[model samples]
Target: MNTGEKDWDKKGWKDVPIAGLITEPGTARRYKTGEWRTHRPVWDPEKCINCLLCWIYCPDSAIQVKDGKVVGIDLEHCKGCGICAHECPSKVRAINMVLESEAEAEDGEKVKEETMREGEEGEKERKEERKGEGGNEK
Candidate 1:
Protein backbone atom coordinates (compact mmCIF):
# COMPACT_ATOMS: atom_id res chain seq x y z
CA MET A 1 0.00 0.00 0.00
CA ASN A 2 1.11 3.51 -0.73
CA THR A 3 2.11 5.69 2.27
CA GLY A 4 -0.73 8.11 1.53
CA GLU A 5 -3.35 5.35 1.28
CA LYS A 6 -5.67 4.86 4.25
CA ASP A 7 -6.53 1.33 5.39
CA TRP A 8 -9.88 1.72 7.11
CA ASP A 9 -10.34 -1.93 8.04
CA LYS A 10 -6.92 -3.16 9.11
CA LYS A 11 -7.70 -5.64 11.94
CA GLY A 12 -6.01 -4.10 15.02
CA TRP A 13 -5.97 -0.67 13.40
CA LYS A 14 -9.77 -0.70 13.00
CA ASP A 15 -11.75 1.74 15.08
CA VAL A 16 -13.27 0.05 18.14
CA PRO A 17 -16.69 1.01 19.41
CA ILE A 18 -16.77 2.91 22.69
CA ALA A 19 -20.04 3.45 24.53
CA GLY A 20 -18.94 6.86 25.77
CA LEU A 21 -16.67 5.11 28.28
CA ILE A 22 -13.59 6.76 29.69
CA THR A 23 -10.98 4.30 30.96
CA GLU A 24 -7.64 6.01 31.08
CA PRO A 25 -5.34 6.62 34.06
CA GLY A 26 -4.88 10.21 35.13
CA THR A 27 -1.19 10.72 34.58
CA ALA A 28 0.86 13.57 35.89
CA ARG A 29 1.23 15.79 32.89
CA ARG A 30 2.75 19.17 32.32
CA TYR A 31 1.06 21.76 30.14
CA LYS A 32 3.96 22.66 27.93
CA THR A 33 3.92 25.62 25.59
CA GLY A 34 7.15 24.55 23.92
CA GLU A 35 8.34 27.96 24.96
CA TRP A 36 9.63 29.12 28.35
CA ARG A 37 11.13 32.20 29.92
CA THR A 38 14.90 32.29 30.22
CA HIS A 39 14.71 33.95 33.63
CA ARG A 40 14.48 31.88 36.81
CA PRO A 41 13.93 32.90 40.43
CA VAL A 42 16.67 32.82 43.04
CA TRP A 43 16.28 33.45 46.76
CA ASP A 44 18.41 35.58 49.02
CA PRO A 45 17.94 34.20 52.51
CA GLU A 46 19.24 37.31 54.27
CA LYS A 47 16.55 39.42 52.65
CA CYS A 48 13.83 36.77 52.91
CA ILE A 49 11.23 37.53 55.59
CA ASN A 50 10.21 33.85 55.91
CA CYS A 51 6.74 34.68 54.63
CA LEU A 52 6.76 31.44 52.57
CA LEU A 53 5.02 33.21 49.70
CA CYS A 54 7.65 32.06 47.26
CA TRP A 55 7.18 28.44 48.22
CA ILE A 56 3.42 28.70 48.12
CA TYR A 57 3.29 30.47 44.79
CA CYS A 58 5.77 28.33 42.93
CA PRO A 59 3.79 26.50 40.22
CA ASP A 60 6.47 23.86 39.91
CA SER A 61 7.03 23.49 43.68
CA ALA A 62 10.65 24.25 42.89
CA ILE A 63 11.32 26.20 46.05
CA GLN A 64 12.04 24.80 49.48
CA VAL A 65 13.04 26.11 52.89
CA LYS A 66 15.07 25.08 55.91
CA ASP A 67 15.15 26.46 59.45
CA GLY A 68 12.31 28.80 58.44
CA LYS A 69 14.38 30.33 55.67
CA VAL A 70 14.26 29.85 51.92
CA VAL A 71 17.34 27.77 51.14
CA GLY A 72 17.32 26.29 47.65
CA ILE A 73 15.72 25.88 44.25
CA ASP A 74 15.56 22.59 42.40
CA LEU A 75 16.71 23.96 39.07
CA GLU A 76 16.58 20.65 37.29
CA HIS A 77 12.82 20.71 37.06
CA CYS A 78 12.33 24.47 37.06
CA LYS A 79 11.12 25.92 33.78
CA GLY A 80 12.01 29.48 34.88
CA CYS A 81 8.39 30.60 35.12
CA GLY A 82 9.26 33.43 37.61
CA ILE A 83 5.97 33.01 39.46
CA CYS A 84 7.71 32.82 42.85
CA ALA A 85 9.64 36.03 42.26
CA HIS A 86 6.47 37.76 41.21
CA GLU A 87 4.71 36.62 44.39
CA CYS A 88 7.52 37.47 46.78
CA PRO A 89 6.56 40.19 49.30
CA SER A 90 9.99 41.54 50.09
CA LYS A 91 10.31 45.21 49.21
CA VAL A 92 14.05 44.91 48.78
CA ARG A 93 13.20 41.70 46.94
CA ALA A 94 14.82 38.67 48.51
CA ILE A 95 13.48 36.67 45.60
CA ASN A 96 14.34 37.89 42.15
CA MET A 97 13.70 36.64 38.64
CA VAL A 98 16.95 36.52 36.74
CA LEU A 99 17.87 35.68 33.19
CA GLU A 100 19.59 32.35 32.65
CA SER A 101 22.76 34.20 31.69
CA GLU A 102 22.39 36.65 34.55
CA ALA A 103 21.71 33.82 36.98
CA GLU A 104 24.97 32.18 35.92
CA ALA A 105 26.79 35.38 36.80
CA GLU A 106 25.08 35.40 40.20
CA ASP A 107 25.91 31.74 40.70
CA GLY A 108 29.57 32.67 40.46
CA GLU A 109 29.05 35.27 43.16
CA LYS A 110 27.33 32.71 45.42
CA VAL A 111 30.14 30.22 44.88
CA LYS A 112 32.58 32.83 46.13
CA GLU A 113 30.50 33.41 49.25
CA GLU A 114 30.24 29.67 49.92
CA THR A 115 34.00 29.28 49.53
CA MET A 116 34.56 32.11 52.01
CA ARG A 117 32.17 30.60 54.54
CA GLU A 118 33.86 27.21 54.23
CA GLY A 119 37.27 28.80 54.66
CA GLU A 120 36.11 30.63 57.78
CA GLU A 121 34.68 27.46 59.28
CA GLY A 122 37.91 25.59 58.57
CA GLU A 123 39.90 28.34 60.22
CA LYS A 124 37.66 28.26 63.29
CA GLU A 125 38.03 24.50 63.55
CA ARG A 126 41.83 24.78 63.33
CA LYS A 127 41.84 27.42 66.07
CA GLU A 128 39.70 25.22 68.31
CA GLU A 129 42.00 22.23 67.70
CA ARG A 130 45.05 24.36 68.56
CA LYS A 131 43.37 25.62 71.73
CA GLY A 132 42.64 22.03 72.73
CA GLU A 133 46.40 21.31 72.39
CA GLY A 134 47.07 23.49 75.45
CA GLY A 135 47.22 26.72 73.38
CA ASN A 136 50.56 25.54 72.04
CA GLU A 137 52.98 28.47 71.58
CA LYS A 138 55.71 26.41 69.82
Candidate 2:
Protein backbone atom coordinates (compact mmCIF):
# COMPACT_ATOMS: atom_id res chain seq x y z
CA MET A 1 0.00 0.00 0.00
CA ASN A 2 2.80 2.33 0.90
CA THR A 3 4.69 2.71 -2.36
CA GLY A 4 7.35 4.94 -0.89
CA GLU A 5 7.01 8.51 -2.21
CA LYS A 6 5.37 7.17 -5.39
CA ASP A 7 1.83 8.23 -6.16
CA TRP A 8 0.66 4.80 -7.29
CA ASP A 9 -3.05 5.68 -6.83
CA LYS A 10 -2.97 7.52 -10.16
CA LYS A 11 -1.11 4.61 -11.76
CA GLY A 12 -2.73 1.28 -12.53
CA TRP A 13 -1.45 -2.33 -12.44
CA LYS A 14 2.22 -1.31 -12.54
CA ASP A 15 4.01 -2.01 -9.23
CA VAL A 16 0.79 -3.04 -7.60
CA PRO A 17 0.82 -4.95 -4.36
CA ILE A 18 0.14 -8.67 -4.29
CA ALA A 19 -3.54 -9.52 -5.04
CA GLY A 20 -4.07 -5.78 -5.42
CA LEU A 21 -4.71 -5.67 -1.69
CA ILE A 22 -3.00 -3.72 1.08
CA THR A 23 -4.39 -5.53 4.11
CA GLU A 24 -1.00 -6.45 5.57
CA PRO A 25 2.08 -4.27 5.24
CA GLY A 26 5.79 -4.99 5.53
CA THR A 27 5.40 -8.73 4.99
CA ALA A 28 8.62 -8.96 3.03
CA ARG A 29 10.63 -7.64 5.92
CA ARG A 30 9.07 -10.15 8.30
CA TYR A 31 10.44 -13.13 6.43
CA LYS A 32 13.94 -13.69 5.06
CA THR A 33 13.83 -15.81 1.91
CA GLY A 34 17.54 -15.76 1.18
CA GLU A 35 17.98 -19.21 2.71
CA TRP A 36 16.80 -20.56 -0.64
CA ARG A 37 19.81 -18.99 -2.33
CA THR A 38 22.28 -21.47 -3.81
CA HIS A 39 24.73 -18.87 -5.05
CA ARG A 40 25.50 -15.40 -3.74
CA PRO A 41 26.82 -12.11 -5.01
CA VAL A 42 30.19 -11.17 -3.64
CA TRP A 43 31.41 -7.61 -3.99
CA ASP A 44 34.92 -6.33 -4.48
CA PRO A 45 35.14 -2.95 -2.81
CA GLU A 46 38.33 -2.12 -4.71
CA LYS A 47 36.68 -2.72 -8.08
CA CYS A 48 33.24 -1.30 -7.27
CA ILE A 49 32.50 2.19 -8.54
CA ASN A 50 29.19 2.49 -6.61
CA CYS A 51 27.19 2.69 -9.83
CA LEU A 52 24.11 1.04 -8.27
CA LEU A 53 23.30 -0.77 -11.50
CA CYS A 54 23.12 -3.94 -9.48
CA TRP A 55 20.67 -2.31 -7.12
CA ILE A 56 18.43 -1.34 -10.01
CA TYR A 57 18.46 -4.83 -11.53
CA CYS A 58 18.11 -6.86 -8.35
CA PRO A 59 14.59 -8.35 -8.15
CA ASP A 60 14.66 -9.06 -4.43
CA SER A 61 16.03 -5.65 -3.47
CA ALA A 62 18.95 -7.36 -1.84
CA ILE A 63 21.43 -4.69 -2.78
CA GLN A 64 22.05 -2.40 0.16
CA VAL A 65 22.85 1.28 -0.28
CA LYS A 66 24.09 4.04 2.00
CA ASP A 67 24.60 7.74 1.36
CA GLY A 68 23.56 7.26 -2.29
CA LYS A 69 26.30 4.65 -2.73
CA VAL A 70 26.30 0.87 -3.10
CA VAL A 71 27.35 -0.76 0.14
CA GLY A 72 26.74 -4.52 0.23
CA ILE A 73 24.27 -7.30 -0.34
CA ASP A 74 21.52 -8.12 2.14
CA LEU A 75 21.87 -11.88 2.09
CA GLU A 76 18.77 -12.35 4.24
CA HIS A 77 16.48 -11.46 1.34
CA CYS A 78 18.68 -12.40 -1.62
CA LYS A 79 17.48 -15.41 -3.58
CA GLY A 80 20.75 -15.99 -5.42
CA CYS A 81 19.29 -15.00 -8.79
CA GLY A 82 22.72 -13.56 -9.73
CA ILE A 83 21.08 -10.73 -11.64
CA CYS A 84 23.21 -8.29 -9.71
CA ALA A 85 26.37 -9.95 -10.96
CA HIS A 86 24.94 -10.33 -14.44
CA GLU A 87 23.87 -6.71 -14.59
CA CYS A 88 27.18 -5.39 -13.31
CA PRO A 89 28.95 -3.43 -16.01
CA SER A 90 31.49 -5.47 -17.93
CA LYS A 91 34.21 -2.87 -17.60
CA VAL A 92 33.86 -2.73 -13.83
CA ARG A 93 32.75 -6.28 -13.07
CA ALA A 94 32.74 -5.38 -9.39
CA ILE A 95 30.23 -8.09 -8.54
CA ASN A 96 30.96 -11.78 -8.79
CA MET A 97 28.58 -14.72 -8.43
CA VAL A 98 30.15 -17.43 -6.33
CA LEU A 99 28.88 -20.84 -5.36
CA GLU A 100 27.42 -20.87 -1.88
CA SER A 101 29.53 -23.86 -0.94
CA GLU A 102 32.71 -22.18 -2.04
CA ALA A 103 31.90 -19.07 -0.10
CA GLU A 104 31.06 -21.17 2.96
CA ALA A 105 34.24 -23.18 2.43
CA GLU A 106 36.25 -20.02 2.98
CA ASP A 107 34.32 -19.46 6.20
CA GLY A 108 34.81 -23.09 7.13
CA GLU A 109 38.54 -22.64 6.89
CA LYS A 110 38.39 -19.79 9.35
CA VAL A 111 36.30 -21.89 11.71
CA LYS A 112 38.79 -24.73 11.40
CA GLU A 113 41.64 -22.39 12.24
CA GLU A 114 39.77 -21.10 15.27
CA THR A 115 38.92 -24.64 16.42
CA MET A 116 42.59 -25.62 16.18
CA ARG A 117 43.56 -22.69 18.34
CA GLU A 118 40.93 -23.66 20.90
CA GLY A 119 42.14 -27.24 20.83
CA GLU A 120 45.59 -26.04 21.79
CA GLU A 121 44.18 -24.18 24.71
CA GLY A 122 42.07 -27.15 25.76
CA GLU A 123 45.10 -29.44 25.57
CA LYS A 124 46.69 -27.53 28.44
CA GLU A 125 43.50 -27.80 30.44
CA ARG A 126 43.28 -31.55 29.78
CA LYS A 127 46.78 -32.02 31.08
CA GLU A 128 45.93 -30.11 34.22
CA GLU A 129 42.82 -32.21 34.70
CA ARG A 130 44.81 -35.40 34.19
CA LYS A 131 46.82 -34.51 37.27
CA GLY A 132 43.57 -34.99 39.28
CA GLU A 133 42.02 -38.33 40.19
CA GLY A 134 39.46 -38.10 37.36
CA GLY A 135 42.26 -38.20 34.73
CA ASN A 136 40.39 -36.05 32.26
CA GLU A 137 36.92 -37.15 33.36
CA LYS A 138 37.30 -40.79 32.30
Candidate 3:
Protein backbone atom coordinates (compact mmCIF):
# COMPACT_ATOMS: atom_id res chain seq x y z
CA MET A 1 0.00 0.00 0.00
CA ASN A 2 1.30 3.46 -0.93
CA THR A 3 0.82 5.30 2.32
CA GLY A 4 3.08 8.14 1.22
CA GLU A 5 1.87 11.74 1.55
CA LYS A 6 1.73 12.24 -2.23
CA ASP A 7 -0.59 9.26 -2.63
CA TRP A 8 -2.87 10.52 0.14
CA ASP A 9 -3.12 13.99 -1.45
CA LYS A 10 -4.11 12.50 -4.84
CA LYS A 11 -6.63 10.02 -3.35
CA GLY A 12 -8.44 12.64 -1.22
CA TRP A 13 -10.37 11.84 2.01
CA LYS A 14 -13.56 10.70 0.24
CA ASP A 15 -11.79 8.02 -1.78
CA VAL A 16 -9.55 6.93 1.11
CA PRO A 17 -11.05 4.79 3.86
CA ILE A 18 -10.43 6.29 7.30
CA ALA A 19 -12.21 3.93 9.69
CA GLY A 20 -10.69 0.75 11.07
CA LEU A 21 -7.28 1.57 9.59
CA ILE A 22 -4.45 0.93 12.01
CA THR A 23 -0.83 1.60 11.18
CA GLU A 24 1.81 -0.65 12.65
CA PRO A 25 3.05 0.26 16.09
CA GLY A 26 6.09 2.58 16.17
CA THR A 27 5.32 3.77 12.66
CA ALA A 28 5.68 7.33 13.90
CA ARG A 29 9.44 6.79 13.80
CA ARG A 30 9.30 7.37 10.05
CA TYR A 31 8.40 11.02 10.57
CA LYS A 32 10.89 13.65 11.80
CA THR A 33 8.88 15.63 14.35
CA GLY A 34 11.80 17.77 15.62
CA GLU A 35 11.09 20.41 12.99
CA TRP A 36 7.99 21.40 14.97
CA ARG A 37 10.06 22.34 17.99
CA THR A 38 10.61 25.99 18.89
CA HIS A 39 13.31 25.39 21.50
CA ARG A 40 16.19 22.91 21.38
CA PRO A 41 18.27 21.38 24.12
CA VAL A 42 22.00 21.99 23.88
CA TRP A 43 24.35 19.51 25.52
CA ASP A 44 27.67 20.45 27.09
CA PRO A 45 29.90 17.40 27.23
CA GLU A 46 32.38 19.10 29.54
CA LYS A 47 29.73 19.52 32.24
CA CYS A 48 28.03 16.15 31.76
CA ILE A 49 29.01 13.42 34.21
CA ASN A 50 27.37 10.52 32.37
CA CYS A 51 24.73 10.31 35.11
CA LEU A 52 22.13 9.19 32.54
CA LEU A 53 19.38 11.15 34.32
CA CYS A 54 18.50 12.93 31.10
CA TRP A 55 18.11 9.62 29.30
CA ILE A 56 15.78 8.36 32.02
CA TYR A 57 13.65 11.51 31.93
CA CYS A 58 13.39 11.98 28.16
CA PRO A 59 9.81 11.15 27.09
CA ASP A 60 10.61 10.61 23.42
CA SER A 61 13.72 8.45 23.98
CA ALA A 62 15.63 11.20 22.17
CA ILE A 63 18.69 11.00 24.42
CA GLN A 64 21.22 8.71 22.80
CA VAL A 65 23.19 6.63 25.27
CA LYS A 66 26.07 4.41 24.22
CA ASP A 67 28.53 2.38 26.29
CA GLY A 68 27.09 3.56 29.58
CA LYS A 69 27.35 7.24 28.52
CA VAL A 70 25.23 9.77 26.70
CA VAL A 71 26.63 10.00 23.17
CA GLY A 72 24.30 12.68 21.84
CA ILE A 73 20.66 13.57 21.18
CA ASP A 74 18.56 12.04 18.43
CA LEU A 75 17.01 15.26 17.14
CA GLU A 76 14.92 13.57 14.47
CA HIS A 77 12.60 11.99 17.06
CA CYS A 78 13.10 14.68 19.71
CA LYS A 79 10.27 17.16 20.21
CA GLY A 80 12.52 19.74 21.98
CA CYS A 81 10.56 19.21 25.17
CA GLY A 82 13.54 20.34 27.33
CA ILE A 83 13.06 17.45 29.74
CA CYS A 84 16.65 16.36 29.32
CA ALA A 85 17.97 19.80 30.17
CA HIS A 86 15.70 19.99 33.19
CA GLU A 87 16.85 16.57 34.39
CA CYS A 88 20.57 17.26 34.15
CA PRO A 89 21.94 17.25 37.72
CA SER A 90 25.30 18.82 37.02
CA LYS A 91 26.01 21.99 38.94
CA VAL A 92 27.48 23.47 35.75
CA ARG A 93 24.29 22.53 33.90
CA ALA A 94 25.32 20.16 31.17
CA ILE A 95 22.15 20.81 29.21
CA ASN A 96 20.49 24.15 28.51
CA MET A 97 17.31 25.14 26.68
CA VAL A 98 18.02 27.98 24.28
CA LEU A 99 15.84 29.60 21.68
CA GLU A 100 16.73 28.25 18.23
CA SER A 101 17.72 31.68 16.94
CA GLU A 102 19.80 32.40 20.02
CA ALA A 103 21.51 29.06 19.79
CA GLU A 104 22.78 29.87 16.29
CA ALA A 105 24.03 33.24 17.47
CA GLU A 106 25.78 31.69 20.45
CA ASP A 107 27.53 29.17 18.21
CA GLY A 108 28.71 31.96 15.97
CA GLU A 109 30.09 33.88 18.92
CA LYS A 110 31.97 30.86 20.21
CA VAL A 111 33.56 30.25 16.81
CA LYS A 112 34.62 33.85 16.55
CA GLU A 113 36.09 33.88 20.03
CA GLU A 114 38.03 30.69 19.40
CA THR A 115 39.35 32.04 16.10
CA MET A 116 40.50 35.28 17.74
CA ARG A 117 42.22 33.44 20.60
CA GLU A 118 44.04 31.14 18.20
CA GLY A 119 45.14 34.07 16.08
CA GLU A 120 46.51 35.91 19.12
CA GLU A 121 48.41 32.86 20.32
CA GLY A 122 49.86 32.30 16.84
CA GLU A 123 50.97 35.95 16.59
CA LYS A 124 52.69 35.79 19.99
CA GLU A 125 54.55 32.62 18.99
CA ARG A 126 55.68 34.25 15.72
CA LYS A 127 56.94 37.31 17.59
CA GLU A 128 58.88 35.12 20.01
CA GLU A 129 60.41 33.18 17.10
CA ARG A 130 61.50 36.42 15.42
CA LYS A 131 63.02 37.69 18.67
CA GLY A 132 64.92 34.43 19.16
CA GLU A 133 66.32 34.53 15.58
CA GLY A 134 67.38 38.22 15.90
CA GLY A 135 68.97 37.65 19.31
CA ASN A 136 71.01 34.71 17.93
CA GLU A 137 72.74 37.06 15.41
CA LYS A 138 73.94 39.41 18.24
Candidate 4:
Protein backbone atom coordinates (compact mmCIF):
# COMPACT_ATOMS: atom_id res chain seq x y z
CA MET A 1 0.00 0.00 0.00
CA ASN A 2 1.24 3.51 -0.94
CA THR A 3 2.15 5.53 2.16
CA GLY A 4 0.23 8.60 0.91
CA GLU A 5 -3.03 6.70 0.33
CA LYS A 6 -2.63 4.76 3.54
CA ASP A 7 -2.19 7.94 5.52
CA TRP A 8 -5.23 9.54 3.81
CA ASP A 9 -7.53 6.62 4.71
CA LYS A 10 -6.12 6.49 8.23
CA LYS A 11 -7.19 10.11 8.66
CA GLY A 12 -10.85 8.95 8.28
CA TRP A 13 -11.21 10.27 4.71
CA LYS A 14 -10.70 13.84 5.91
CA ASP A 15 -8.70 14.49 2.75
CA VAL A 16 -11.82 14.24 0.61
CA PRO A 17 -12.26 17.26 -1.62
CA ILE A 18 -14.67 19.88 -0.22
CA ALA A 19 -17.47 20.76 -2.64
CA GLY A 20 -16.83 24.54 -2.66
CA LEU A 21 -13.29 24.73 -1.50
CA ILE A 22 -11.71 28.03 -2.52
CA THR A 23 -9.52 26.79 -5.38
CA GLU A 24 -8.34 30.28 -6.17
CA PRO A 25 -6.40 31.99 -3.41
CA GLY A 26 -7.27 35.51 -2.32
CA THR A 27 -10.90 35.14 -3.39
CA ALA A 28 -12.20 36.34 -0.02
CA ARG A 29 -12.65 39.80 -1.51
CA ARG A 30 -15.73 38.59 -3.35
CA TYR A 31 -17.48 37.71 -0.09
CA LYS A 32 -19.16 40.52 1.85
CA THR A 33 -19.02 39.46 5.51
CA GLY A 34 -20.83 42.61 6.67
CA GLU A 35 -24.20 40.96 6.19
CA TRP A 36 -23.55 38.83 9.26
CA ARG A 37 -23.36 41.85 11.54
CA THR A 38 -26.17 42.36 14.07
CA HIS A 39 -24.97 45.80 15.16
CA ARG A 40 -23.27 48.54 13.15
CA PRO A 41 -20.77 51.21 14.01
CA VAL A 42 -21.86 54.84 13.73
CA TRP A 43 -19.33 57.61 13.40
CA ASP A 44 -19.92 61.01 14.97
CA PRO A 45 -17.76 63.43 13.01
CA GLU A 46 -18.31 66.29 15.48
CA LYS A 47 -16.74 64.34 18.32
CA CYS A 48 -13.98 62.71 16.23
CA ILE A 49 -10.52 64.17 16.77
CA ASN A 50 -8.94 62.54 13.66
CA CYS A 51 -6.67 60.53 15.95
CA LEU A 52 -6.52 57.62 13.40
CA LEU A 53 -6.75 55.07 16.21
CA CYS A 54 -9.86 53.54 14.72
CA TRP A 55 -8.24 53.24 11.34
CA ILE A 56 -5.26 51.50 12.85
CA TYR A 57 -7.29 49.07 14.98
CA CYS A 58 -9.87 48.03 12.40
CA PRO A 59 -9.30 44.34 11.58
CA ASP A 60 -11.31 44.46 8.35
CA SER A 61 -9.62 47.64 7.10
CA ALA A 62 -13.03 49.29 6.77
CA ILE A 63 -11.90 52.72 7.95
CA GLN A 64 -11.47 55.19 5.12
CA VAL A 65 -8.58 57.57 5.65
CA LYS A 66 -8.29 60.66 3.47
CA ASP A 67 -5.94 63.62 3.64
CA GLY A 68 -4.37 62.22 6.80
CA LYS A 69 -7.82 62.19 8.45
CA VAL A 70 -10.45 59.51 8.94
CA VAL A 71 -13.25 60.50 6.55
CA GLY A 72 -15.68 57.69 7.29
CA ILE A 73 -16.21 53.97 7.91
CA ASP A 74 -16.67 51.63 4.97
CA LEU A 75 -19.71 49.54 5.83
CA GLU A 76 -19.37 47.17 2.91
CA HIS A 77 -16.41 45.33 4.37
CA CYS A 78 -16.90 46.14 8.04
CA LYS A 79 -17.82 43.02 10.03
CA GLY A 80 -19.31 45.02 12.94
CA CYS A 81 -16.52 43.71 15.16
CA GLY A 82 -16.66 46.96 17.20
CA ILE A 83 -12.88 47.06 17.31
CA CYS A 84 -12.84 50.58 15.97
CA ALA A 85 -15.32 51.80 18.53
CA HIS A 86 -13.64 49.96 21.37
CA GLU A 87 -10.16 51.03 20.35
CA CYS A 88 -11.14 54.68 20.02
CA PRO A 89 -9.51 56.83 22.66
CA SER A 90 -11.63 57.30 25.77
CA LYS A 91 -11.32 61.07 25.51
CA VAL A 92 -12.88 61.17 22.03
CA ARG A 93 -15.23 58.16 22.04
CA ALA A 94 -16.32 59.24 18.60
CA ILE A 95 -17.39 55.81 17.42
CA ASN A 96 -20.46 54.15 18.86
CA MET A 97 -22.05 50.78 18.21
CA VAL A 98 -25.79 51.20 17.65
CA LEU A 99 -28.47 48.68 16.84
CA GLU A 100 -29.11 48.71 13.10
CA SER A 101 -32.81 49.37 13.51
CA GLU A 102 -32.33 52.11 16.09
CA ALA A 103 -29.86 53.90 13.86
CA GLU A 104 -32.33 54.02 10.99
CA ALA A 105 -35.12 55.29 13.21
CA GLU A 106 -32.96 57.97 14.77
CA ASP A 107 -31.82 59.24 11.36
CA GLY A 108 -35.40 59.57 10.16
CA GLU A 109 -36.48 61.46 13.29
CA LYS A 110 -33.56 63.87 13.01
CA VAL A 111 -34.45 64.85 9.46
CA LYS A 112 -38.11 65.38 10.34
CA GLU A 113 -37.29 67.54 13.34
CA GLU A 114 -34.88 69.67 11.34
CA THR A 115 -37.43 70.24 8.60
CA MET A 116 -40.14 71.30 11.08
CA ARG A 117 -37.82 73.70 12.87
CA GLU A 118 -36.74 75.32 9.59
CA GLY A 119 -40.35 75.79 8.51
CA GLU A 120 -41.26 77.42 11.84
CA GLU A 121 -38.30 79.78 11.59
CA GLY A 122 -39.20 80.75 8.06
CA GLU A 123 -42.79 81.56 9.08
CA LYS A 124 -41.54 83.77 11.90
CA GLU A 125 -39.31 85.69 9.50
CA ARG A 126 -42.19 86.21 7.05
CA LYS A 127 -44.41 87.56 9.82
CA GLU A 128 -41.71 90.02 10.89
CA GLU A 129 -41.33 91.22 7.28
CA ARG A 130 -45.09 91.74 6.96
CA LYS A 131 -45.19 93.85 10.14
CA GLY A 132 -42.32 96.04 8.88
CA GLU A 133 -44.12 96.61 5.54
CA GLY A 134 -47.37 97.62 7.33
CA GLY A 135 -45.55 100.24 9.40
CA ASN A 136 -43.92 101.64 6.24
CA GLU A 137 -47.28 101.82 4.38
CA LYS A 138 -48.88 103.80 7.26
Clash count of each predicted structure:
0, 0, 0, 0
Worst 10 residues of 1 by lDDT: 26-35
Worst 10 residues of 4 by lDDT: 129-138
Pairwise lDDT winner, candidates 1 and 2: 2
Model 2 scores worst on lDDT over the 10 consecutive residues at 129-138
Which parts of model 1 are misplaced by more than 4 Å? 1-37, 90-92, 105-138
Q: Rank the candidates by TM-score, best first.
A: 2, 3, 4, 1
Candidates' TM-scores? 0.48, 0.59, 0.58, 0.57
Q: What TM-score quantifies how close candidate 1 is to the native fold?
A: 0.48
lDDT for each residue of candidate 2 in 49-92, tens digit (9 for 90 to 100)? 99899989998767767677876677666789999899899999
lDDT of 3 at 102: 76
TM-score: model 3 vs. ground truth? 0.58
lDDT of candidate model 4 versus the reference: 0.67
* Cα lDDT tens digits for candidate 4, 44-67: 999999989899899977776767
lDDT of each: 0.58, 0.69, 0.67, 0.67
Give the lDDT of residue 82 in candidate 3.
92
Predicted model with the maximum TM-score: 2
